[model samples]
Target: MDTTSVWRATAPKAALPSLQGDIATDVVIVGGGITGVTLALNLAEQGIPAVLLEARDAGFGSTGNSTGNLYETVSRGIHRIIDRWDKDVAHAVTVARREAVDQIERRVQKYGIGCGFRRCALYRYATSEEGKERVEKEYQGSLDAGLRVRWEPSLPPPFHPPHGQVMVLDNQAQFHPQAYVRELARQAAGHGCLIFEDSMVLEVDTDQRVVRTVRGKVSAKHIVLATHSPKGLHLVQAGMVVNREYGLATRIEKDGFPAGIFWGSGVDRISARELGVDDETYLICVGEEHKTGQEDANINLDRLEAAAAAHFHVRDIAFRWSAQNYAAADSLPYIGKDATGCFIATGFETDGLTWGTVAASIITDEIIGRDNLFAPLVKPSRFSPVKGAKGLVEENVAVLKSFIKDYVTDRPGIPLSQLMPGKGDIVKVAGESLAAYMDPNGNLLLVSPVCTHMKCKVHWNSVEKSWDCPCHGSRFAPDGTVIEGPATEPLQRHFLQDVE
Candidate 1:
C-alpha cells in the first residue's frame, strides 16, 4: 500500500538546498512544480534574476502524482468549454493548450531530458450507451476547437470494444511529469535561477513582495503563487471545487498495452496508459474522483483498484497515489494578479500538467512586458458567474454546511486507550475533543481540530494519514504540519498521552 506514485518512484530527484538567508531577486516563484520551474527557466532564459522555492521536492504536488497525459481536450470534456463560452473561446483554449504540449516536447528535446516523452493519439471512447452522447459532443467540440479529431471504429489493445463513439485526437503526448520537472529545475538552475527545495513559505507579504521560509526569506519585485491552491486566503478559493482523484499502477508484460492516453466514460470515468520504467512495464489507471475530506479515501482507492482489475489484466498493484484538483467556478483557471496584486495560478482541475505550463508562459510574458494572446482568457480578474454558477453554488453550500456541522452537531469521540496503532480519530481527552493519532510505536499525538485556513473542522483522511479540511482542502500530517492547500500554518499541536 505504498502511496508514492510510479513517476515519483522512478524519476531521479532534483537535488537542491534549502534557503539559508534572505535573498533578493526580480521574480520569486513559490512552487517547484511544472509551473514554477518552467517560469524560473523562462525568466532565466530572458536573463532575469529569479528564485524558485518548493515546500518539499520538485514535482511533489500534483505534478508527480498526475496521469502524465497531455492533450488539447480536458478530462471534463471540451464540450463543457464550448457550451459555457463559445466556439471561438473553445478554439482558443485548444490552441493555447496545444502550444503548451508542444513547448514541453521542445524542452525535452532541446535539453536532451530523459523523461520518456512521446507523441501519441488520444482515444476518448464510451464504455456504454449511456455515455454515447458525451463522446459525440466531445468529437464535435474538438472539431469546433480546431483539433484534428476523427471518429475511430475501435481503440488499441487492453481497451475493450467501444460501446458508443470513439474520438481520436492525434499528436497528443505523454511523458514522465516528475522527470520533466526535475530536468526543468536543473535547466533553470544552470541558467542562473536559484532553486530551493524544502523551503516552505511560512509567510508571504504581498505588499512588500517578500516570502519567508522557516530558515530564511526571499525578497523579489514580483511573486507568483504557483502552489496548487495558492498559500493563503484568496477570493478564488471560494469559487473553486477541491477534489482528490486516485491513481494506481500494476505490472504488465512488455508491450502489453498501447502507448496512448485512453479515457473511457460510461459506468465510470477512467484514464489508462502504459509506462516502461527501465526493464519493467506498468499499466496506470486513474479515476474515482471525489470531494476532498468529504468522501472516504480508503473506499475510493479500493474502488479504483477494483475497477482497474475489472477492466484490465489481473496484475498485482504496485503503486498507488492521489492528487488534489481545484476546478474554478468560471470553468477557467485563475492565472493572473488578483486583488492582492500578487500573481496567482490555480483551478487547473485535473489538467494541471498542461495548464501549469500555460500559466508559466503567461506569467513570464507579463513579467517581461510582452503581450500574450491567451492571458486575457485566464486572468484572475475576469468574472464569469453565469458560466461558473453551478459548481460555485454547490461547493459553497457544502462549505457552509461544514461550518454548521462543526459547531452545531455533536461528534461522538473515542477514548485514547481504544485508539489503535496506525489509527486516528477525534478522541475525547481531558473533557476536550482533540485530533489524536496512535503511531505504530504506540505514541499518542494530539492537535487542534480547527483548520488554520478558515477555522473549519479537520477530518481524518485514513488513506493518507492526515487531517483534511473540508472547506478549503487544507491537509496536515499526523504531526499537524501543513501538506498542501491554502493553509500556511500547521495545525495547532497539543500533547495528550503516550501509550506505553
Candidate 2:
C-alpha cells in the first residue's frame, strides 16, 4: 500500500534535513522509526550520545502505520508457536512481551508524552465452533504462561462469536502510534541526540562497529539495525524476519460502542479499535493479513469496508492505509548482538509497537553492559528446530511461487470471466497492470501489480481488499492512492486502458 493516506498523512513535516556530506558521531543508529527512536531515547536517558538517521522521515516505515496496540498477545497464532517451540521457551517469550507492554505504559507516564494513550481490553474471538475450542486451549496456555486473561462466551459489535468463546486480555492498550513516536523523537533530540533525515545506511562493518550512510559514517561501540527488515551488507539477516501486510482503515463514529481493541479469526481476520483525538472519536478497522507481498491487490480494502459497514455503519473512511512488518516464525523478535558490536531487532510479528520497545530495552542494556532477563529469550542467533524445517518449507514455497509468477504466468491480460461483478481482477492500469478486485457492487478498483519501490508485484489481499506490495512493504487503494510505503508515489491508474 502507498503511504498516501496511512501514517504519511499524520506526519508533521520532516524533523531534520537529509544526510548530506560526511560527519562523525559517538553512536549512529540506522532507521528512524519507532525502534530506532525508542532506542535513542532510552540511550539519551543514560547520557549516551546517539545519532539517528532515516532514509525518509520518521514513521515512514512500519512504525508510522502501526495500529498502536501495546499488546503482549501474539498476532501470529499462538498455537503455531506452542506446537513448534518448547513450552518453556514459549512461556518466556510471552512474559518478555508482556513486560515490554508494561514498560511503554511507564514511559508514557514518566515522560508525559501525552499521545492519547488509553488502557483498554483486547479480545480474540473464535468465529467457528472449532475455532472456539482452539481459543479455549490457547486461553489455558496463556493462563499457564502467567498472563492475565479470561475466556468469555461472546464479543462486542460486528462480531457475534456463535462459538461463544473469546479470549480477553485486560490492561492491554492502544494509542496513536505516530504521536507516540514523535514524542519520543522530541525527547531524544532534547537530550543532545543528533537526528539526520533522508540518510539511508548503505553499509555496516560490525567488526569495527561502524555504520556508513549516504551522508556520513558513525563509529560507535555498537550498532543497531532497527530497520523493519535487516539491511544487511555483508552478513545474512534474512532468517531474523518474515514480512506481512495489513488492511486499510476507515474512520467511524465512536458512540455507544464498547471501547477497546478487537480481532476475530477466519479467512478474513477482522480487527478494530476505538480511537480518539481531541474531541473526535473514530474507529480504526483493519484486517486481511497475507504473507507480505502476495500477488493479489485491492481486495483487502473491500473486505475492510464491508466489515466496517456490517459492524459500525461506517459513514466515511477518513483515512485509508496499509502496513507491512516482519514476523519472526519463533514468535519473539531477534533482539541481540549479531557480531562483535552489531545488534538486530526485527520480526515483531504484528505487535512491533510493543516488541520494538522491548528490542530497544534489550539492545540498550547490552550496549551499556547491563544484565537483562530478556536477552536470552530474544537472542538474535538462537536456533529453533521447529522454525528450521517449517520456515524453510514456507520460504522455499514463497520463492517458487515468485518464480512461477515472474516467469510462467501470461501477465499481459486476464479474462473478464475470472472477475465477478462485485469482485476485482488485476489488469493493465496506467503503465503497470496488476491485481484489481471488485466489491459486491462490481465497482472497478485498479492498483499497481508491481510495488512502487521494489518492483515486486503487489498482491490483491482478498481478506482486506487492498493492493499489498510483497517487497519493501507498500500498499495502495483501488484508485492507486498509496496506503503505505517504501514507495512514496501513488500507483498509476490503468482502468481507462482496460475500458479501451
Candidate 3:
C-alpha cells in the first residue's frame, strides 16, 4: 500500500510561490490548510485584501490527509455539548455546522470548482449494547438540536445490518479535500490576495500587528492564526487534546458497496465512505484513534485494515495515511478573536472540514466589521471554567505525564548497524539523545530527539516514518524538517561521526 493519501496522490499540484520581501495587507493568515484558504477566499470575496502564508504547499498538512467527510455532529458527540453547556448552545452548534456545509456547496458551485463535491446521507450505527445506548442518546440530542434524523432498525448488507440500530442524517457531503482547498487558494488569489507557499511565519508581534518570516514580514490590520493549533496563543495549545487517527483506502467491488457515509459507535468507532475515481471505486475507512504519540502507528493501521477486510470486499489496500486533530476541552472550537486580538480557529477535532468553513465565515465577518451570529458562542477568549474544568484537568494531566516520562526515560542506544532501513528510533549517541533513521540507501540520519515546541522527547512513528511529539502533536521528517506542529522549528541535526 502507498503511504501517501489518495487525495494528495490524485490532486493537482499547487504552484504558488514563496514570500519574497516585506509586504502589507488588510489581513494576514498564517496557514494554508482548509481554514486558512477558506478564510482567504471569504475575505477576498468581501473585497478585503489579505496575504496568506503557508509553511508548505497549500493543503499539504492535515487537509490533504483528512478523510474528507463533512458532518453536522461534533466528533465527541452532540450530547457532550449539551452536558457541558445548554441545549441552546448545542442547537446553535448544529445550525452553524450545517451552515458551514451549505457554504461549501455554494462556493463550489459559484466558483465552478470541480472538486467532486457531493451530498450524501450519513448513518450512525451501534454494534454493542453500550453503543446502542450512546446512539439513542445522540439521536435524542440530534433531534433536540433541530436535526432531522430517522431511526433505522437495520442497515443494508455490507454493514452491521441486524446487529444494531441506526440513526440516519441526510444531506451531509464529502469532497476531494486537497483539490477543493487548492482551488480555494486559486480563487482567493484571483480576488487579489497574495498567496505564498513555503513561507514560514517565524514570529508574530501581536502588539505591532506584524508577522515575520525569514524572507519577509506582513503588517496587517488583522491576523488570523489558522494553524492546527494556534502558535500565537499559548493558552489555546493548553486547552486542546491532540489525537492521531489512521485511514486506509481499499479498492472495492461495485455490487455491494454502499453509497453514503457509515459510522459505528463504541470505543473503536469506525467510519467508512466510498469514493469514485474514473470508473473505479474505493472504500475509505478511518478509525482507531489514540492520543498523539501514545499508540503504535502500525497497530492502528493493522486494526483499520482488519476492520475493512472483515466488513467489505476489498481488492487491495490502495492508500494509507494518518491525520492529527485537536479537540477542545469544552467540545467546541475556539473560532474568534483571542485575548491578544488576533483571530484564531482551532480545536476542530475530526469535523474540521465543516468547522473550518465556519471559522472562515466568522472571521471574515469580524474582519469586515459585521457581527457573526455564532461568534459569541465560539469566541476564542471565552472559557467555561466550571463546565470545562474536569476535561481541562484530565487532558493537562496526560500531557504532564507524557512530558515527564519522555524527559526522564533513557534511550535504547541501538547502534547504526542494528537500525533497519525505512525505520527510525531514539538512541543515545555521544552521551546525548538522538533520533536516528536509516534511509533506503543505507545512509544514517540523526537529529535531536527533543521537540522544538516544548523540549519534550519525540517518539518515532513507524507507520508514518516521522518523529512525533507526544506532548503537543508536533511532527518532523527524518531529515529534521517540520512536518506538522504546534512547533515551528525543525529538530536539530546531529552528525553521525559524533556518535560514541
Candidate 4:
C-alpha cells in the first residue's frame, strides 16, 4: 500500500525553480499548496510581485492528498454552524463557500487547467434513526442558510440504500487538485510571480517582513504563513486541534459507480466519490479520522478498505494516503493578520479545499488594500469565549497530557537487534528515549523521539512511515526530515553507536 496520493502520483510534475541567493518581492508566500498557489495567482493577477516558496513541489501537501470534494457545506454541517453562530453567519459562510467553488470553476475553465473538474451532486445519508434525525436537521439548516437541498427517502444505487434518509445538495464538484494547483502555479509564474520549489523557509522576521531560507533571504512588505497550521505562531497554534484521516482509491468498473459525493452520518462517517483517472474510474473512499498521532494508520487504512469493499464492487485498491487537518476552536478558519502583523490561514478541517480558496480570496484582498466582507468572520485575532472556550480547554488539556506522559514514561528497554526490518520503536538507550527504525538492508536509523515543536514524544506512524507529534501535528520522515509542521526543525538524528 503506497501512501502517496493518487492525485500526486497521476499529475504531471511541477517545474518551478528553487530559490537561490537573496531575493526581494512585494509579498513572500510560504507554502506551495492550494492556498499558497491560489494566493500567488490572485496577487499576480492584480499586478503584485509575489514570491511563492515551497519546500516541495506545488500541491505536495494536504491539498494534493485531499479527497478533492468541493462543497458549499462543511463537515461540521450547516446545522452545527447555525448552532455555533447564528442563521445570518451560517448563510454568509455558505455564500462564501459557494463563491469559492465558483472561483475554482472559473479559473479552471479560463485557464484550461485540465484538472478533471466536474460538477456533481452531494448526498449525505444516515444509517440509524438518530442519524436520520440529524440529517433532517441539516436539511432544514441548509434551507435556512439559503441553499437548495432535497430530502430523499432513498439514495441511488452503488450506495447501500433503504437506510434512514438522505439530504442532497446539488452543484458540488470534484477535481484532480494537483493538476489544478500546478497549473495555477504555472499561470502565476507567467504573470511575473516568482515560484520556487524545494526551498525550505527557516525563519520569519515579522517586524522586518523578512523570510530566511538556508541559502537565500526574502525581503517583503508582507508575509503569508500558508504552511498548513501556521508554524512558529504560538498563539494561533494554541487555538487549533489537529486530526488525521485516511483515504483509499479503489478501481471501479466504468459506468458501474454512481456519480455523486456520498457521506454517511454518525461517529464513524464514511465518504465516497467516483473519480476518473485516465480511462479508468476509481472509487475514492475516505474516513477513519482520529487525533493526530493517537491511533495507528494501519488500523484506519483497514477500516477504509473494509468500508469500500462493503459498499461497492471493488476491482483493486489503487492508492492509499492520509491527510491531516486543523479544526479551529470556533469552527471557522483563521484568515487574517496575526498579532505579529503576518498574514495566516489555517484550521479548515475537512473543508480545506473550499475554505482554503476562501482564505486566499480574503488574504489577497487584504494584501491589495481592498475590503473583503468575510474577513471579520475568520479574523485570526478574534476569540469567542462562549463558542470556543470549551473546545480550547479540551484540546490543550490533551496536549498537556501527551507532553507530561511522554516525559515521565520510560522507553522500551530493548536492544536495537530486536527491531525487525521496516519496523520502528521508541527504545531506551543511554538513559534517553530514541526512535529507531531498521531498513530492509539492516541499517538502523535513530533519531530523538522528542518533537521539535513542543518537546512532545513522536509516535511511529506505520502506514505513512513517519514520526508524528501528538501535540501540534508536526511530522518527520524516518531519516528525520520535517514533513508537516508547526515545527520547522527536523528530528535530531543519532548514530547507532552514539545511542548505544
Judged by whole-model lDDT over C-alpha atoms, candidate 3 comes out at 0.85
Candidate 3, 33-140: lDDT as tens digits? 999999998888888889999998999888998988888887668988999998999999988999998989998999998888999988888765668888888889
Q: Relative to the true structure, how large is the alpha-carbon lDDT of every model?
A: 0.90, 0.68, 0.85, 0.87
Off by over 4 Å in 3: 254-256, 409-412, 415-417
Ranking by lDDT: 1, 4, 3, 2
RMSD of each: 1.6, 6.4, 1.8, 1.4
Residue 194's lDDT within candidate 2 is 81
- Clash totals, every prediction: 0, 39, 0, 0
lDDT of 4 at 374: 90
Which is superior by TM-score, 1 or 2? 1
Worst 10 residues of 2 by lDDT: 232-241
lDDT of 2 at 351: 81
Off by over 4 Å in 4: 411-413
The candidate that achieves the highest TM-score relative to the unseen native structure: 1
Writing each residue's lDDT as its tens digit, candidate 4 over 1-500 gives: 47888899889887989988998889999999999999999999999999999998999999998988998989768887788888898999999999999999999999999999999999988854557777878888999889999978888876677357688899999999999999999999999999999998888888889999888999999999998888775587886889999898877778877888888876447888888878878888888898898888898888878766766655488799999999988788899898988899998988988998999999999887889999999998897978888669878987988866676665354666678998888876777778988887888889989888888889999998899999989999998989999898889999967656
**Clashes in predicted model 2:** 39
Candidates 2 and 3 compared by lDDT, better number: 3
True-structure lDDT of candidate 2: 0.68
> Cα deviation in Å at residue 210, candidate 3?
2.7
